[model samples]
Target: MNSGISGYVIQRLLGTIPILIGVGIVTFVLVRVLPGDPAVFYVTGPVVTQEAVQAVREALGLDQPLYLQLFHYFGQILTGDLGRSLTTGQAVTVSLMQRLPASLELSIVAMTLAIALSIPLGIIAATRLGTWSDYAIRFAATVGVSLPASVLGILLILVFYYYVGFAPDPIGRLDPFVATPQSITGFLLIDSLLAGNLEAFRSAAAQVALPALTVALVVMGPILRITRSSMVDVLTSDYIRTCRAAGFNWWTTYVRYGLRNALLPVLTTVGLIIAYLIGANVVVEKLFAWPGVGAYSIDALLASDYAPVQGYMLLMTALFVVINTMVDVLSALVDPRVRAQ
Candidate 1:
């Protein structure tokens, strides 16, 4: 079984290379094809000239043939060079490394909230299929699924900002008044805790909570619904009935027998949710002014910064692939039939 799993993992990792190349090609072409030139976007003042635009294009290697440009870009990436940002002229990899942790921390918190809330709610809903609790859970999940993220974000902002007055300003990851902690992981919350700065940690948490919650609320609904449905099916299986008939208590039958089987499907959905959350962070990040890769991608798009945009797309694609592969492996482990096949 270990060998089989290892082989499977190796195969998936090998497959990712071609997938990443395809993603790079598609993203490169799409960004290039988009209306407006990056050079012109950067040059806005009276000092802008045709020569300046050409110089910008040359600096970006936009003057090369399409295929040659892609080859050069790929070569640079292979050597651990992500190139300079068009807007800042700083190294793209460095910029991403600096900003990625804040987004990752937020995503972790949001996904943790989503899984913690969804699984139990789903299980309860499924267990009490015809009860008021079930109905209430269903209604809540429906509302979560139906509401747009933008509206949800606005509502959260209003309630927290106006009603509570404890909300932090929607600008970057930390307040300007507070000094940022030393960059260990680049995650303010973790760094603050590590550095023993309680105030910094509190500030980080306050700033992150709204955006994270906004993302969680939007993502939690589908996970809840899917988990409920899967749990319901598992509960109806013969093993569960047999367990009940064998005089096992309701809790044991439901939790041990039913939940283990139910979790296979839920795990699959959760993996997808994680992937979607990574991509969907764009709007939440923007609304809250969180410095994440999603926001970086948006800024790159607005400025037509192809390198950063391409890098972002490639990173997201890689993440999705890795997550999906993990889900597949986990599912195989949970379901013996997959390994048997």
Candidate 2:
């Protein structure tokens, strides 16, 4: 069993190498093909001289042959250098390091919120299939799926911040008056608590709640639907019927047997949800004025700064690969059939 698991994990890791290389190659080619010249965008004045634009292009290595540029980029990537941002003049890695934690924190919180609410509701709806409870849950799930994150975010701000006056200002990560905690971890919520700054923690949590909720609402529908369908299938399986006939109680029969069997599909949905959350963050982050990589990438994209956009795409691709590997391993552990395969 141990050897099989090891083989599976090793195989997954090895397979990801080519994927990363492919993503890097595609990102390099696609960014170069985008309209507008980076040098022209970077150099701006009332009357910009051709010499200035040419100099900027050379400095950024944009004047190099495409093949040479690709080789240089791959070399830099191998050396753990993501290159400098043409707009900000900071290392792309540095910016990612600073901003990724924010995006991750938001994603984590939203996923937690979604899973916490979705699974139980799904179970209830499954157990009560054909009843009013199931219909209500299904209706709500449909609405959640249909609602756009941007619209939901604006409505949340209006209802909670403007009308209700419960939510904090829909601004950055924390209130202006709150002193940011010392950065032990880049996550504000964790770093605040680590530094024993409850005030900052509360402020950060409040600021994150609305946008996180917005993201959760957008993702919750798919998770709930998957869980409900999986559970319904498991509960109706022959083994479950056997358990029901063998005098096994409801808890042991459903909670233990049904939920365990239902988990694999739900787990897969969760992995896909993480990717969706990353895309949703691009909109939610901008709406909330959150300083995360999604917002950072948007700024770079508007300026046609190729390095940062490439860095963002490569970073996100690598992240998805890691998530997929973990999901595969977890599915294997959950079901012996997957491990045997």
- Candidates' lDDT values, in order? 0.87, 0.90
RMSD of 2: 1.7
Over 1-341, each residue of candidate 1 has an lDDT whose tens digit, in order, gives 59989899999989999998899899978999999988787766788899989987897678889999989989988987877787878888888887778778888899998888988899899989999999999999999889988899999999988788879887878888988888888889989999998889999988988888888888899899988999899988899889988999977898788888888778888888887677778888899888899999899889888888888888888889898999989889998887676
Mark the regions of model 2 whose C-alpha exceeds 4 Å error after superposition. Answer: 242-250
Best by lDDT: 2
- Ten contiguous residues minimizing lDDT sum, candidate 1: 37-46
Q: All candidates' TM-scores?
A: 0.93, 0.95
Q: Residue-wise lDDT of candidate 2 within 195-282, one digit each (tens)? A: 9999999999999999999998888899999999999999889999999999998788877999999999999999977965764589
The residue pairs that clash in candidate 1, if any, are none
The RMSD of every model to the true structure, in order and in angstroms, is 1.9, 1.7
